[model samples]
Target: MNINIFRRKRKIIVPVLTEEKAKETLVRCQSCGNLIEYEDLRKNLKVCPYCGYHFRMTVSERINLIADSGTFSEIDTEIKAVDMLGFKDLLTYKERIKQTKKETGLDCAVITGKAKIGGFNAAVGVFAFEFIGGSLGSATGEKLTKLIEYAKKHKLPLIIVFSSGGERIHEGIYSLMQVAKIIQAVDSFKESGRLFMPVLTNPSYCGAAAIAMTGSIVIAEKGSLIGVSGPRITREVANKNIPGKLKQAESLLQNGFLDTVVDRHLLKTTIAQFLKHYNRRTI
Candidate 1:
């Protein structure tokens, strides 16, 4: 059988993106389902322009956003976690630590340092959730304790950004011990009469929430999950359908659990204003 087929050639357009180009291109807004350009998102400090949803920021990004340019001096950079238990489940604790270090480039879950915020010196500690969900462990607690002590010694205000999943179960009882260490450190730091401000971001749960709540003034980013346990765990433990809004920053603020809930766009300015006001009163 012989058949005659006439086909029209059409132009095919396929966009090729390099690694850098692909990363810098369009990003989907999780809240509003808008496809936003990456540059626009960065300009807006990674907030969703459509629905005003604040995106989670990296440690470096948060530091740059809050600290003055060339003013961040990181301390306790050499502290790294050790596999004291040598325990293994799916992977060894040592292996897990190594993997997270390779991925996040952090010695521990938290980074402690001194930074100048709005021209005022303060000891700053920021959690990197990329490091094993920013679990509270011995190393993290030590770093935080040192940060508090440094703040007290220098008579500087203390600012810590809390973002953690809870205690690191891998570290066993050692991780749980950190809660006491943190509380004691904060208690002594309070005696100095310097401000201790905690910035609670998304997923501030369990021990992290407890530590942040101890701050002289607690501020949470808008839409942050500020609670002891997350919704799922709370539902399972209580055996009831927990209210979805109960653990949110807005709800916490309304219920007197939070001092302020600031939008991402105004977070730096708001914190600076608080610092300035507090310093003036003390002076």
Candidate 2:
């Protein structure tokens, strides 16, 4: 069968989104009342367009900004939690673990790795707040131990970025044991004469704050919360009105708990300088 058919070509219109188009909708800076483009804000690492105030960053973002490009080698990637007690609160412990894994793309709160800061090799560990409120559990403790061992073996300095709610309540005693475990790990690193620097981010409370303070050079982000207990708990236990910024980073600095309070905008540069100073001092 032969049939003559007239074929017509259809023109397809595709929509392309660009920064200029996005900027047509203005976003005011939280710190300063200045209109700016969303793309520009992100490009500047979430700093305020006018005031230069830094926005809170995620653990992964911090790692990417601090570590030298293409130098991050992750450690203890396969260590995961096991529900030994079968505990349950509002949700099953096992289900909670699974959900955290799915949400954070991590088996545990801490990600241990090796990376370079200002060309100096170091062991890096970053705690993910998205993972069970960055709880310190058995897995987190084990990873910290391994990181210390790795640093000691290679004679590399250790840098830990800490932000956690404290010990994992669901894990009970197992979680509490991490405090001793990580402290011992830090002690081992100290005995090896290696430098340990812990940079505390916002809400570095409970076990995270305790372990992070073990560093020889402890630095905290400005405006961060650094304490053993949250405000609610402190108020409940103290049975009094607590100051609004009682446990803030600045308060900790005033109390000599933190070695330094660093601005988030210059965090990477400051950390790099610290690593450089330590490398020179050790050598």
Candidate 3:
């Protein structure tokens, strides 16, 4: 597969509430150059009709795809990112949080909850890349840790869908600390002999990559990328450009970094099948 095709700029399809708005919206596939109606694209699980390119999905879309209908119950809804250090760039951390919340309707980059997946209950957390690139912040880590603990208590399977860019820079050291906290939580969860399934999606970098790699089974969406650091940082540190195929899911599967690379359409079915197998073994 030519991973270069994924590097091209594609039209961003904003979710519209009304049917009329959805009908009026059109997105162009970056890989195949096909014009796709927003409604049709959504019904097709946001995969391009012509080229089968898997487009990035929001947290709600992802949850809907994987979780059984009306079975997800969210936890830690009140926890939100704050301006811990009063960090400022062009915008203050407070301003950025407010703006991101308004834009994405999310309190943090990830949402954690108890959900029935393929009719089996599990603890699930999903990351939305639009929320500050799904960066891991203090609140994000807290929620995930709590979720892992909940799963541990209940002896339920843990599933985390990672689509993060890196640690949230606005929180500085606080953001970095989350990696340690989460790792501790994950360790405790694993001691109970429960399964940890990490589904890596597009742009899983830095701390996200570390956590996902620790899972019992590492799964990746087709066309996703998994790397320690992004291109700019790699160029500065290593004095070289990131190899095009180095982080691609297909390449990772070949090199044994991932257990499987699943298509977006088949993800729910595949995951359910795994859960069934795990359940049978445990029983």
Candidate 4:
């Protein structure tokens, strides 16, 4: 018997989601351009096996991936966005909210819930980018505030996984104001001796990022963006070109901003370990 024959073969790379292939069973990887089976892609937790590109997930998917089965229940499910300032550009704010709700089955950008990760009870809040770019609006602000309160009252560790395109420009100043409100909530949680974890996902910038920066143990996905503003806007404001990787989570960790940058596959285990370590005293 040859030793080479016992070794497993590596997969060949292939194009993105848009390109067509002869067999419908194959799909291309977005980052590395490798062709992978749809089922295999899903089994890998949507992370590209070739390049380690972490794909975005819906709120439901995030919960199912992290929370123990039959242990997650959403709080504040009825909150909806308001058309403050009667905002209208290409589309009216009211219409945008309605359209996003219908499409995403989410009233706002975040889903606040109570769940047990690794058998440790915790309060979790996950942002859904499918709704209006996951921007912070009045309803989003309210939910964040309430989630903190619920966690503090229950004495459970809180995990807020955020990925936002910034403040809701559609709401004008009202959206920008949420930054301070959420920051205050973070302070309140800390004052009560509760563990607050802010997990940044892809494209996490702007007002939401400001609030998340205050987490007790700040963590982010490996390739996530972590900054106040995006590269284009920062360049325009500073009148200088920024490095392409400056806003990424890996860069932030190197710069002493993030506690750790974990891959999506290990996110649940890492968070659960943190919860167990901190939650023991309280329980």
> Which 10 successive residues of model 4 have the least lDDT summed?
14-23
Which pairs clash in the backbone of model 3?
none
Cα lDDT computed for each candidate against the true fold: 0.84, 0.80, 0.88, 0.82
Q: Say which prediction, candidate 1 or candidate 4, comes out ahead on lDDT.
A: 1
Q: In lDDT terms, which candidate is top?
A: 3
What TM-score number comes out for model 4? 0.87
TM-score of each: 0.89, 0.84, 0.90, 0.87
Candidate 1 vs 3: which has more lDDT: 3
Q: Report the C-alpha lDDT of model 1 over 1-283, residue by residue, as the tens digit.
A: 2211113232322122223544768977767789888778778887889998777777778899999999999998888888888878667999989988876678899998999898887899999876887899889999999999999999999999988889988899999999999899999989878899999998799999999999999999999887777775576566677786788899999999899999988888988999999999888
184-274, model 3: which lDDT tens digit per residue?
9999889889999999988799999999988998899998878988765676567789886788899989998899999999999888988
The best-first sequence of candidates by TM-score reads: 3, 1, 4, 2
Alpha-carbon shift of residue 245 in model 4 (angstroms): 1.4
Give the best candidate by TM-score: 3
Clash pairs, model 4 backbone: 13-34, 14-33, 14-34, 14-35
Model 4: per-residue Cα lDDT over 1-283, one tens digit each: 2323113452433222221232346666657778777667667877878899887766777788889999998999888788969877556888888887777667898889899999999999998876877899888988988999999998888999997879988887888888888888889889999899999998798887888889999989988877888775676567788886888999999998889999998999999999888966666
lDDT of 2 by residue, 1-283 (tens): 3211113332322111223444556566545768776677667876666786555555677788888899999988888877878988656889999987765567888889999887878899998876877888899889988998999998999999987879988789999998998899899889988889999987788888988888899998877888887775576567666785778888889989999998777887888898888878888
Would you give me the overall lDDT of model 1? Answer: 0.84
Model 4 Cα RMSD, 1 decimal = 10.7
